[model samples]
Target: MNGLKGLYLEDLVVGQSASYGKTVTETDIVMFAGMSGDTNPVHLNQDYAETTMFEGRIAHGMLSAGFISTVLGTRLPGPGTIYLSQSLQFKAPVRIGDTVTAKVEVREIIAAKKRAILETNCYVGDRCVIAGEAVVMVPSRA
Candidate 1:
């Protein structure tokens, strides 16, 4: 994957798409928990998770959403992208073994001011675990 470093403000198209992903791992869950201070028992203590609605632990919703931001920062809008806002709904829990693929597609691009509307989704297998829209600012190279 290319590093997002030179995306100025004029390279975005309204129909472009970007995608990237990896398998979820317990280490990732633990690390994210430590970094974000979101160590809910369901995400850390397996014994406690065994009592939850899922009958096991589930990854944080924001963790899946992070994948979406990664795709945008490293692919579509690239490095110079600024996130304005985003809204997404979680449709399913992401287990530790689930391989999540995050994708973002441009729905509208405001070329005059270098802003864009993007539709984003995070999927685990055939299930759409999360989906939503995001507003971003892309800086032009020129």
Candidate 2:
């Protein structure tokens, strides 16, 4: 496939990878809370969060995880990729202003099924904030 249409199944290699980065912000957390209907105090109420293990308000875990989706949907597999499954492990807190970089690498390809298993990860500087695996159905040239 051409760049505009994303990579076709045949175009993928096991080690191919891509990444996208974004800085977490107060507006991002607030908007995510509203859009996801998860007004958890840990993510919204600073005082309340101060009592938690984080000791301060932290951006939602899913917000960081969502960066993985951004990398998949717009970067590696690009625009036509269909996400089939994902497994995630949240490891650290993401505070407002932290720049999160989401990375995805093709780990395995099942040509018969037109599917690819990718290793997905999000990092803040050198610390991994989220780690996961994703299965996606990629377009083909046939």
Candidate 3:
């Protein structure tokens, strides 16, 4: 909670960009699997996944997306950020060895409403796996 700094209501600029990096590990996938109860064979069974279109076990869509939240919570918009809504598209598959870089950009700011519209993206080795926009409420500095 104390980690949030740099970002305040008046400091945000529309069209500004922010980025954060994270390395995804197998443990992250396994833990998310246990917590979300999505034990699909493709995510849990390497052998089964080898036979699927991906040809190997892949990370969960939501797990990859969660990195976006991590970036939002810790950087850019920071704490007191309330997620109003998200529109996303899962565009590619993420394998266990991949390191994902999640990015968010401020697209529009509603100064009157203390809200910001952000464009979000997740990339794995140059390929975009998730892209979306989120409407968030950032507490006014005043």
Give the alpha carbon lDDT tens digit for every residue of 76-99 in model 1: 777778899999999999999999
RMSD of 3: 1.7
> How should the candidates be ordered by lDDT, best one leading?
2, 1, 3
Q: After the best TM-score superposition of candidate 2, give how far the Cα of residue 100 lies from its true spot, in angstroms.
A: 0.4
lDDT of 3 by residue, 31-71 (tens): 99999999998988989999999999999999988888877
Which has the better lDDT: candidate 2, or candidate 3? Answer: 2
Candidate 1: misplaced stretches above 4 Å? Answer: 1-9
lDDT value for candidate 1?
0.87
Could you give the candidate ranking by TM-score, starting with the highest? 2, 3, 1
Best model number under TM-score: 2
Candidate 1 shows a clash count of 6
Each candidate structure's TM-score, on Cα atoms with residue i matched to residue i, is 0.91, 0.97, 0.93
Locate the minimum summed-lDDT window of 10 residues in model 1: 1-10
Q: Between which residue pairs do clashes occur in model 2? A: none
Candidate 3 off by > 4 Å:
1-6
lDDT of each: 0.87, 0.94, 0.87
Report residue 24 deviation for candidate 3 (angstroms): 1.7
